[model samples]
Target: MNRERLFSQLVSHSGPFDIAIIGGGATGLGAAVDAASRGHSVVLIEQSDFAKGTSSRSTKLVHGGVRYLKQGNISLVLEALRERGLLCKNAPHLVHSLPFVIPSYHWWEGPFYGIGLKVYDTLAGQLGLEPSRYLSREEMMELLPTLETEGLDGGVVYHDGQFDDARLAIHLARTAVNNGAITLNHTRCTGLMKEKGHVIGVKAECVETGRQHEIRARCVINATGVFVDDVRRMDDAKTENIVAPSQGVHLVLPREFLPGESAIMIPKTDDGRVLFAVPWHGRVIIGTTDTPVEHASIEPRALPDEIEFLMTHAARYLTRDPRPCDVLSVFAGLRPLVAAKNAESTAALSRDHTILVSDSGLITITGGKWTTYRRMAEDVIDHAEMIGGIGVKHCVTHDLKIHGSATVLPKDDPLAVYGSDATEIRELTAKEPEWARKVHPKLDLTCAEVVFHTRHEMARTVGDVLARRSRSLLFDAQASMNAAPRVAAIMARELNWDAETIDHQVNRFQKLASGYILEG
Candidate 1:
């Protein structure tokens, strides 16, 4: 996970490559691993740090798209569920099942959802994930004691996998590197190189050193999430714009807001969107309003209107009304839905991915969720090999074991921690109290986890360490702001950065972290 070693590998492999992947998000990283594991020399370049885009801005769920099932996209749902199972098996440390409670208000609501959940369970029968169960009102009350019991009839509990999406991307990148793939972050692809109207390579600039380089390859794949269209337009002016950005936002509050082990899923809302109050990283995470966005940018700031929208809906089930001040942090992400000619609402747009081979021979892949990243990578690589005249190899990612997969705690172990509850902190503190005291003297995050971020997680900045690696920024942006100086010092000592560099990183992190906090 040494940044220098990774950069050295990329600089060493400047010759012609079997595959050159543009964009270092989940799909691109997955493709790199898939292709490189098959013995193909691979090079992956990103405009910013890895997983600095939508891949890190997800709801952090690896479940089958239940909404897709409602839309009767059975094939997509089944495919995603199967992939979720594979990810759970292959990366158990990063992907684990979380129980979700779907509250029912109407008399027939319970049976209606129960039947659908039964169908969902049937699809995932052999996948080894826990099946759905019906919870009586009393059981529901016991599970979610804070829920308002005014109109509750019963509930249906189902199991779905949850994960740290950015960490998963990091692990995929590490796995690719371990298998001989050269992956470089902070590397931007400026232009596509062509010979006789065919894309033969790419022109790139290193953001860190401002150095220019050209990577020659037989095939170039564009897996940039919302930015795929930009790369496509570079290849062919006539190429249609295929990405419509959809904005989704999440709010973080204290765990005392809904002290529970199970997540609450609000199925139907007046605004035609589903709401979820899930426990994550020792705090409660309530989210996600789907709004349309025209521009695609990292560190998307959540709007006040969107914040109010979520609070209005979430207040229905909570014991106390959650005010704007209760929100510890907020985040927004733009979804790259493949743009249809007359697309209306981004939510109605397709979640499925589209891979296009342009006239200039650039393969652009976009429009998929975190759960289906593996499948998206397979499809993109399959098309890349076909167009580049390179032989395709069978994907080994299904049975492939990611980092920490072998060391993941067993499911039946009594000491196993579930969800992002305080159990994780307690376990870490019990094992490494000195580390815990250094990172989070007030909270539960440990110094060991911070060290682990630099040693194994490739965390280069305070924002990267707290925001993505440790979930501190996601849960409590203010706490992360307070911890930034200390984290910067630790990173400086470990990464060999000087005082000036540490101060620069701290200022940058503050600017980024401040955007997530609501100001009067």
Candidate 2:
């Protein structure tokens, strides 16, 4: 349904809800889905589009933190590993088994990561994807033909899971709706509502229409990710900050850069953190520097140092280094790390999530890895049930397949993106063949997909079309900019925009797309 209808429907609700989640990112979306699955009345809202924040800007791995395993946090590793398995089982279309190769420059490196990976595998028990094994230089060379093999002795192969993070968020939201949860994006929780000194609801604003509403819920969940502190203070003005925001950056390159099924895992970087070079959506995805930031921001950019950090490190390992000019798109995300006792470095903090109840009864869940989001949700909703005194129930997400997901996806390009729902696109193509044609020559995306997103996925603007719905903006920034007019035209028709609105959308998309292109 369109957002206008969503607002009217929510405004029409006269009774209190069993649960009201205040963010549409991973944890919040998961909570909505879980709470609804247990038969609780649910309503969720996001200030921006779904997955517009840190949720969409992930490393795209649903892995058990191999780094956590090194830190001797076996329990967390075990938990993430099991969740990784369940995600693959439930949403096989979005999440799947991926092989990772840790290439060794020194002789000891292979055996070192291999042994650790063996322990990682053992922890998974029956849920493990594949056993970690030592690969000869020949085997490693065969898998990753582009690696610089001068000092490479051998490598280790292990199994992990990778997924489309933003798409998964959308699926979770849809699944939640399927299970009777009402949702809206572009809706912000401006304040918390209290009665007798306990939070009873929230004061939310429709960001688009400038309309205000009081959403009275029996329980309010603060799943605002790195922005949890902002929501927490709404309940108590004097509370200390609870989240230590950690920024991470990633660069997207053409898939030819990796040209391998197995991803490259640099177990350690110059800064004592792990980085990944993974293949995602026909592109090579390289990332991640963990540096603590003083504040959380909605529009976080990759610092120049972070860009250098990723390129310098990644270039060292590849046969042909990916220069800034070679980068197709660069995006940054913040990790919501729980504030620790005199934590010196965000990299030193735990990736595990935290759930806290303020004195005013605002339930806040924050600080976790994307790999363990479902578990994080289950924990939050368990507490949600406890705090709200709602009936206790089990989390069915362990085996719950996401919406539009399938047992098998199409083997071809574009259509494969829709997973089991690819047939729907095929139907759209049948009606108007031009909808199936690419907006421009370089991209493989079809116009029909844009129609599908607006008609079904609640995409209302050019940014939603490029950034989230189709990921055109994420894969290739300049190309998305080049295709903006055509995309805006399609959106203008679907959204019924006037000339000024269409121009605004095209200009806004262009400005945003430029950020993804690194400056020389």
Writing each residue's lDDT as its tens digit, candidate 2 over 1-520 gives 4566667778788898989999999999999999999899899989999999999999999999998888899999999999898888888778778899999989888878888888998999888898989999999999999888999999999989988888888878888888988888888999988999988888988886778989989899999999999988888889899888999999999888899788999989999989899988889989998989999998799999999999998888889988878899999999899988977798778678888888777899998878888888899999888888778888788888888776457434566656767788789999998898897776777898888888878887788888887778778889999999998899788878999999998998898888899877
Question: lDDT of candidate 2?
Answer: 0.87
Q: What's the number of clashes in each of the models?
A: 2, 1
User: lDDT (CA) for every model shown?
Assistant: 0.82, 0.87
At residue 33, give the lDDT of candidate 2.
90
Looking at candidate 2, what is the lDDT of residue 353? 87
Compared with the true structure, what per-residue lDDT tens digits does model 1 show for residues 1-520?
6667877766777568889999999889999988988788898998887888898888888989777788899999899999999999888877888999998889898899999989999987688478888889999999999999998998999999888887778778878988988888878999999999999999989886889988899999999999998898778867777788889999888888888778988876776777889887667888788888878886677877898888888797898888878888889988989877666677788899888888888898989888999899888888888888789788787888886565665544422222222254456557866655656554455676676677665777787788766667886788788889988887787888998999999999988888888764
